[model samples]
Target: MLDANLKKQLDTYLQNIVSPIELSVSGDNSPKSKELLELATEISGLSGNISLREAAAGRTPSMSVAPAGQAPRVSFAGIPMGHEFTSLVLALLQAGGHPSKASPELQEQIRNLEGQFHFETYISLSCQNCPDVVQALNLMATLNPNISHVMIDGALFQEEVNQRQVMAVPAVYLNGEHFGQGRMSLEEIVGKLDTGAAARKAAALDDKAPYDVLIVGGGPAGAAAAIYAARKGIRTGLVAERFGGQVMDTVGIENFISVPYTEGPKLAASLEQHVKEYGVDIITDQRAAGIRRGELIEVPLASGAALKSKAVILATGARWRELKVPGEAEYRTKGVAYCPHCDGPFFKGKRVAVVGGGNSGIEAAIDLAGIVEHVTVLEFADSLRADEVLQRKANSMGNIDIIMSAQTTEVLGDGSKVVGMQYTDRVSGESKRLEVAGIFVQIGLVPNTEFLQGSEVELTRFGEVVIDNRGATSMAGVFAAGDATTVPYKQIIISMGAGATAALGAFDHLIRAGS
Candidate 1:
């Protein structure tokens, strides 16, 4: 049932619809289906222009919204609950002749696009990042008949999800081929589509003449390195599966030195822009599979292409460590989540739990407490590991509850979504169950250095690349930085400084070799 306050807000948003929209719901008469239907009916009742109807049996719960005369080109298959609720609302507004949120340049590109293109975006209902991508694709579909898009609920279609090997939400497939994953900007989406439509593949680089510097990864560290190397008038090349790395998944970042406050995507965009200002060859959508050291270092790509470089800088960042408990994997997008910033909105007005009592966990709890009904933080340690200031702030929040010595045993779900979780008290040896709509895991991070296996790169036991003060690795002409390295701190400012140091070290190596 919709809360009165939420219903009122939805009513206000719907009242401004300038055109009529049709919402078609479909599914068996199961409890989930009925719940979705009831919500749809209530939404439809709020506005006179909006109407609802049931689709044929076996079809998933989908909404096909279109203006009075136009046929629906955008369809969403899922309950559109959680953070996805905003996606539904935006879709309806677009169908009702509202202006698109995409940039004018993007809209022009979409209109100019030719040939048939099908975009299938897999999303978890709770993922906040998924909506922007889905909405952008949907807007493209609405603008051009040749382009079409559909949103697939990863949790509802387990078989399809497994077939695609979807590891995370916001996984976009272009023309049945996996395009990319995570929070992608409109430019990235359009660029991928352009490449996919042309059937372009990575080409092997000529070993005879290698780049002056080749950077692995495309986070703040790699981007900074590229810019610095390019400033030295060298042939700089950067290879990355995605430009922003883990920063794209992050939200508010206040401690970035000069920048008093900024969001992750905003900072990432600035980094990419700064790198582009130089002569760095930014190669996106490519993963470094392995490295071979010789006179010229060779980095092999997962796409079967190899790039050779005189010097290499490894800045492959880290990913959030997962809790390997039961139901954690099965209900990853359903209820269990890693990024509170990305999925917190979906749990609005609902009780949620956060596993961990570190600074990140406490920050997540405080951030979620503003939107969610209540936030319960469970920590395995005897006391909170967060800073005293952060702990005090979290404690002051009435909606936030901190539980110490609580070890998460399992995530409990109803085969569709997360319903609650079980934990054991470390001190008391007592088991307890907490009914929660979602669980945000804020464990530490694991470095992404598996590609360095069998390579000459030195690494710590935790898999982080070993580096010196100058960011120089054990191997000559090779460097490492960012969270993947043995840096004392894993902050953005520190990574950028490390990257600059590595670039300077590489430049010095090149100068000495030339001398």
Candidate 2:
């Protein structure tokens, strides 16, 4: 199933296996089963330490990886190809007793888990976010014998996907019940299962000494700021709910300068690695609750812990703008999705609607036209705001229909899943309903400044933090940058530049204030 180059690389990775391992194959005479067996055989052939055996499991066309004679803890219910191929490789190494890159504390936390955990994650092959969840669970299963995880391909297992009403990728289930439905770090997953870990960690954070510069986000802007501050020979720290921010949901990023092409997750990983090279104290899985202005600026976390710093840089970034119509939140995962690249595959051969006319919406329509039966683009404006090149490409597609001056009013669902969408004709003042199985909202972004509401910091009417040319905010000793600030552009490169400027501005403030 793998090409020659892929086999060569797998061979190189398999050399890292220090202990004996086994591949337990469960399959039938079906084509998928045969394909799986072929892939398993190819993997087993790479190293002498690896062996294979047929086994009976509840799910067919599955393979389990573990040490010889041990009950396999890491299993794949479907072919782990595409984005999950890396997951397959990692599972092999971890199951073969190779040490993981996870922190020693986190590994111990997994080992101390008390109960048996059977995690099943539904994923699509094209999803960039699914691998993180899958790989994390797989590592947990490897670290703790009581934990077992199975990665299930949603597209290949349509029956289960429909039964679970899984309209989104990276949907996780624990012990046959819903656990989560998005990108989650290993720390976040373990904190959920361990229950008391959050409070303990929060208390530890509360006791930390004040930093010279504290960054309140982990996107590109926050990363750049952390690097700059750390390089300035000062105490730098960064806190974030997630490191990647909105970039994690992004798919193709061809416009980033210096690099010809890259994906969101890859760039986010590089940014994180670069920040780690500095002396910055990186804190994850923590959301900023509010900021308090004082002699030393304070940023409180949602977990009840507050961090203090001489200066603070707010780069909380932004999130996808939602359609605030009725039934939209009720059926968010049921049928309404915000990412076309992540959730588009779930609506194969079904009709879907794109609720915007910008570049993102038109691009989504063009991408979905190949998979879905039909795509209707709804534009509240009279003309599309997409680039002329994109408009031309979308117009050339037969399955795409552009609806001008159509305002989305409501999402229609049958309690279980989406059945259609309701919109209003702005010009004719007529209400219209279109039968679509899914609604992909491609509207612009809203700054993630809700946490800053009621704070002393001045903000624009749109909730963006008002900033000067030096990136300093109205609040003394506090600066802002990136999407959270009133920046004219929201591109990645622009965010990075703003981050550097904010860091420098904070440093200047610290020097002048006699910090």
Candidate 3:
């Protein structure tokens, strides 16, 4: 566990000096330098940015990706608490924005392997801007054999730019293809790698023959598909950008039927374990670029690996559609939180808010009532959309209060932490502020099917993978299930059942194809 004083001191450091551009600011350390940023730089990778280290040591610190670029310049490991996390990588990404020649390894691989090495580092010359971006990219290129970069001047890159037909400084062109123009955010770049990786994989797989079963998502659905099919005597393989799917973010998953109170991480871990136990080959951190036609399915991986399978099951689950309010993304751990189960324990006896009015929201508020000192539920609807049971439970909680027709207007906080929130009453257009330690978003979930870029798998109007009674999809030898599928319920029990059903269907398809 991070010492309380240390965490607080780190919080102070984050608010005053941390910015994605800090790129952890200067690998060179000089004690004579009297700047918070320099101090930040010195201590940024203190733990070697190793989340695994803390976990192995039995201390809980939730860390996601560093602020920028492909690899770890500062290795923003551990739960990215504040601006320090951002500073760690921004410097590296800033370095990416140059004609700065790289080592032979970078020059040979990333410069042309996938196509072109195009990148735009968004920054001003300030220490807060360009330095981190450049350094982060340098670090990232070390891991990926095929990635190189060039920088664009912040002042000149902004001049009368022709984003189209290519006359731009801060933009990258990949084999004459424009990657992006204007200021590139971290999320934007992450999305870019996703497609870029997928594109390369799809192209490579275009030549392969299909297999018995090809699972599109590497989440609960795909993992289950691989396990069940392998168990039932069928050849199967799973592809996804990241293994364990969003379930990895889930600290614990108690609602997942059969298992009444399991950590989400534990559940996902066990699922991955079970799949491997059945001899199901699980590809971690790979995406399905595309699925080509054949007697079976020819699925491509973002890593340029091609896989073939007879039937494909899209177990791609759902992701939380963010509020997109300002501080929501910026100050995530610094007071802005998502999962009640994950971050709730940290705020014991503190005030918090839950967004939305449906059963999910009401249930969350009701659950939070017991833990936090105060619980405020902001609902966009006139009345709660929760079922009677949840509504009754929420109404019964003294600490929980509901505000109808309320919508989040702005997430206001110190640059490094969230201290309050602003909302507008739908009826009167009146705005108000609420002070809370965290806000839970129970608004909705989005199915993960972006990989179906060119496939025939049908999706519902709501973006779910369409499936028949047995969890079969519109395409022959393909199956669908879990939240991503057209299954009405997104409950865990239903997802498991659907996963089983699809596995069975894939097994049947395999048997018939073999016979």
Candidate 4:
């Protein structure tokens, strides 16, 4: 269907448009700027050719041509950096080729409510967790381009945000209304999206993750936070690196007030289940890496996607501290690991050592005794530090051996694989070496807060973010909760309370800013 001249021009455009050389010139020119310039000239020539072709066909000169076989898909609104790049390019290509019909029945419905939305998100450039918020929004927009998304940097958009009454990065505005502040689930958007009453005029939009609030984390604190936040009538979203936080590595949670005998993971699961009843957005395996702070928050993911949000709650729990022993890092996946539940099954019939004499070490050793051929528990303390019950259980396990007053001096490996370990006796000053197939180090955990550098916040001596009774950090428009902060007596129940407090503080910040 293409005329000879038009086809030649189209092919030429495609060929030159994708070159790195064309992306930039060596001097002061920028890649994107030059790329756009080159594209404009090509488009102009292409447009002129199309016009002439239409005129010859007896159609009006202003009429658009069908390129090869398709209609052009045009961008109706904003497309900045991050995941929007692909969407924008695709839209332009489709616009040049063919228009696509709405893929879902909800298309028309979204169009009706399109005029009612005004969304803005704010985020910090340095924050790792901010990227998830970016992807969620981009996905929503791609699902229906009628939904407009505006991104603003939280640091730079401070003045505009204060005018809008925003107290944090990652804020959303719906129909000129403040939707909420913090990390949101698709469900939250769905709830705010008007698909009812007006459905008689437009088709019904299919149900998706329409959330009121989304709490990210599955630790005791995350669960507790969700219980409180969701009870307040908001759809919550929860994304955890794992189901539980540091406590999940714990054998038991003794000081959790009333829960006399509860394990970490089970408790986490219970909380997760409870939050699900309230329709919280629970996403596991989704990690936030980079944040774009502004009126709208954009979070880039480890998977190269992004999520956007109005406000965000970080319940990303911390990881246990490693001894950083020699060979530890080198042999990580080959024969050393942290979580026994995840890697224990692979070590079946293999000899392994669990480092540490604390409750965690003993607990891990006992668990591994059932799976691995042999379990060696190493302790640097004079005697076992774990509770009497755990010690008793470790003693009863025939294949489990406890070596007290010993520390791992070196982790030995064969470059490509872990082979053994070197140990020193604290009392006798004697050294011993043991060959093992696997090593599971369980000392304790470090707060997963390394990503908050350069942000307006205070960190404890231990590097945890310091916060007050209300989960208010030293900075304005910013607050932190969960294991990453400096709330002592790190318990699941306590963290949950802390998360709830933080969310409330965020709510207060939003109310004050909005009012």
Candidate 5:
């Protein structure tokens, strides 16, 4: 099933395998089964250490990758192609005893887990966030014999998805119970499974010495600031709940300078790698709760640990703006999704509504028109705010309908999932209802400045941190940048520049303070 170029690449990757492994597949005479067998056969043909065998599993058309003649730990219930293809390669390498790049501490944590964990993840091939969760669980399975995992393609196994009422991609189940949905990092997963891990980590963090510059986010802004600060030859540290922030949820990134094209997760990985090269102390899976100003600026984490720094750069970034209407929160992931790129596949052949008229909203409508049966766009303004080209493209699509002066009132659901949406017509003063299985919200973003509400830092009415040209906030010694600040434009390149400015501003403050 793999092309010649793919076979060459696969062969090169398989050379890293140090031990024997088996691809035991369970399939029947069906076309999908044949496809699975063909894929396994092609993979086995590349390396002498790899072998193939026919086996029985609860789910047909499944393939298990494991050590030779041993119980399988990592399995796939459907073809692991598209975004998950990398996951399959990693599974093969890890199963064959190739060393994993996970930190030594994290590997040890996985090996020490006491209880059995059978994880089943349902995902769509088009989802940009599914690979992270799949690879994370697969890593756990490969590390601990007590843990096992299976990645199931939601589109290929519609019956199972319906039975579980899984309306979102990357839905994970632990021991047959709903564990989580959406993008999850390996560290987050381990933290959830190991209850005492957080407290121990917090205690360790509390003992660390003060930093010259501390960055409180891990997006492009935080990464750039960390690199700039570390290069100044002073102590630098960065804390992030997740390294990528909103960028991780982004899809195509064609506008980033120097690089013509890239994806969100790929760019995020590169950013992390670049930051690592600078020897900055990086902390993940920790959310900043609040900041306290003293002789040294202190940032408190939700884990009860406080980090002190001579200068603090706030680049906490932004998140998707919610509808906040009744039933919207309850029906989230039950048919109300924020990311059209990730959740659009699940709404194939169904009607859906896009709740905005800007670039993001119209773009979502255009993208959904290809897969969904019909797309209804509800714009609160009298006219569309999207670019003329986008408006023209959306208008050209036959399956798309645009409504003007629409004010979304409430999301209507059948107590289980979304069945429709209610909106008010500002022009006619009429209430209208549209039957849609899914509601994709693409309104805008809300700055991640809620934690600074009670603090002395000045904020705009919209909660954005007020900053000067040097990226210094209202409070002395505390700088702000990126989407969380009062930057005029919220773009990746702009954030990077803002980050550098903030780092320089912090350095100047430190020099003056020490003098």
Candidate 6:
């Protein structure tokens, strides 16, 4: 249910629509179904041009928006709540004859498609990236008769999620094949569709010609390393599953040293552009499966290709550590999330919990306080480890409540979504429960180093690659930087500096070895 102010705003938005829109709501007697039906009824009542009808229940709760003349092919298999609320509104607007925001080229491509294309995008209500992919597929489906799209909420369909091995949100299936995951651009989706390729080919690797310096990971650190290596005018190569790494998931980044303000995607674009300006052989959409340390390091990719490099810079970054508690995994994306920026909007006006007292957790609380109704921070330690400045800011927020020495025991959820969290106060040895819609786990980070399990490269107890002052690892001709390594801090600026140092170290090593 929307508040008075939001309902008024929606009423104003719907007043401009001229075309008639039909909303078909179909579901069983489930709670999710009742919630969706109530919301749909309320939304349809706001506009005279819109109408709501009941459809036969199928496998799951579903809703569809049909334009005046077009058949109903665009459907959502779950309640489009949270950040996806906008998606539902936009679907209604589009069904009411509003034009799509897709580029002319993309519109033409969708219009001229010959073969039938069906897209099933599995998404969480909290994912910030899902909206773009879902909207793109919906637009294509609405524009073309042969194109059909379904947005499936992964949390509500755990069996399907497990069967598909979907470990992440925004997992897309084009014609029943896993197309890709994460935030994808409309143009990228169009390109993939037009090319009819589920996976993009990496840059050709020649075993005979080994690269002088090969950089792994494509975050800020790896990008900087590639730029530095390319400046030497040597054969440099960079491989990454994605270009932006953690930076892509971030939203507001005000502390990038000199930059006054910038978002994550903008910074990621700039990094990619800067890397492209040089002669760096950048290979994307490929993950390094393993590394063979020898005279020439051999890095095998998941795609069955191998790359040989005289020197390697491991800039692989870190990911948010999971709570690993009961209901945490089950309610992931349903209410349990990692990135506040990515999923915070979905919990607007709802009470949420932040599981951590460090800088990230405090920051998350501070950020969510402005959007959500309330924020409760649970710290495992007796005191928060975040800087005084962050703690001060968090304390200033009236909506934030910090609980120290709190051990999260479980993430309680309904069969379909999260409803509350259970924790224990370490000092009192008493358990407690907090009724909240979402939980953001920001305990810490885990380095992306599982692929290097048997490699000669030394790693710390925490699995971070051990590096010297110059970013050189224990093994010769091997270097590492960024959060993946034993770096003091995991900031973007520091990672860039580390990457540069590693590149210089690699160049110096090559020079000495050649002499």
Q: Which sections of candidate 6 miss by over 4 Å?
A: 1-115, 118-181, 184-209
Off by over 4 Å in 4: 1-218, 233-270, 277-285, 290-293, 296-311, 345-350, 371-374, 396-399, 427-430
**What's the lDDT of the predicted structure labeled candidate 1?**
0.83
Give the Cα lDDT of each candidate: 0.83, 0.94, 0.59, 0.58, 0.94, 0.84
Better of 3 and 6 by lDDT: 6
1-515: candidate 5 lDDT, tens digit per residue:
99999999999999999999999999999999999999999999999999999999999889999989789999999999988999999999999999999999999999999999999999988788999999999999999999999999888888998899899988999999999999999999999999999999999999999999999999999999999999999999999999988889888888898899999899999999999999999999999999998778899999999999999999999999999999999999999999888889889999999999999999999999999999999999999999999999999999999999999999999988999999999999999999999999999999998889899889999999999999999899999899998898989989999999999999999999882
Answer with 1 or 5, whichever has the higher TM-score: 5
Q: What would the TM-score be for candidate 4 when compared with the true structure?
A: 0.52
Worst 10 residues of 4 by lDDT: 19-28
Off by over 4 Å in 1: 1-128, 135-144, 149-181, 184-199, 204-209
Ranking by lDDT: 5, 2, 6, 1, 3, 4
Candidate 2 per-residue lDDT, tens place, 1-515, comes to: 99999999999999999999999999999999999999999999989999999999988889999998798999999899988999999999988878998899999999999998999999988899999999999999998989999999988889999999999988999999999998999999999999999999999999999999999999999999999889999999999999978888888898999899999999999999999999689999999999997768899999999999999999999998999999999999899998887798999999999999999999999999998999999999999999999999999999999999999999999998999999999999999999999999999999999998898899999999999999999889999999999999899999999999999999999999988
| Candidates in order: C-alpha RMSD to true structure | 8.4, 1.1, 12.7, 20.7, 1.1, 8.6
lDDT of 3 by residue, 182-208 (tens): 323332344365556545434645554
Which digits, one per residue and each the tens of the lDDT, describe model 4 over residues 101-193?
322434444444555344556544332223335444544553454554444544343456446644333556665777765445443455356
Give TM-scores for every candidate, taking all chains together and pairing residue i with residue i. 0.71, 0.98, 0.56, 0.52, 0.98, 0.70
lDDT against true structure, model 3: 0.59
Better of 3 and 5 by lDDT: 5
> Which ten residues in a row are the worst by lDDT in model 3?
53-62
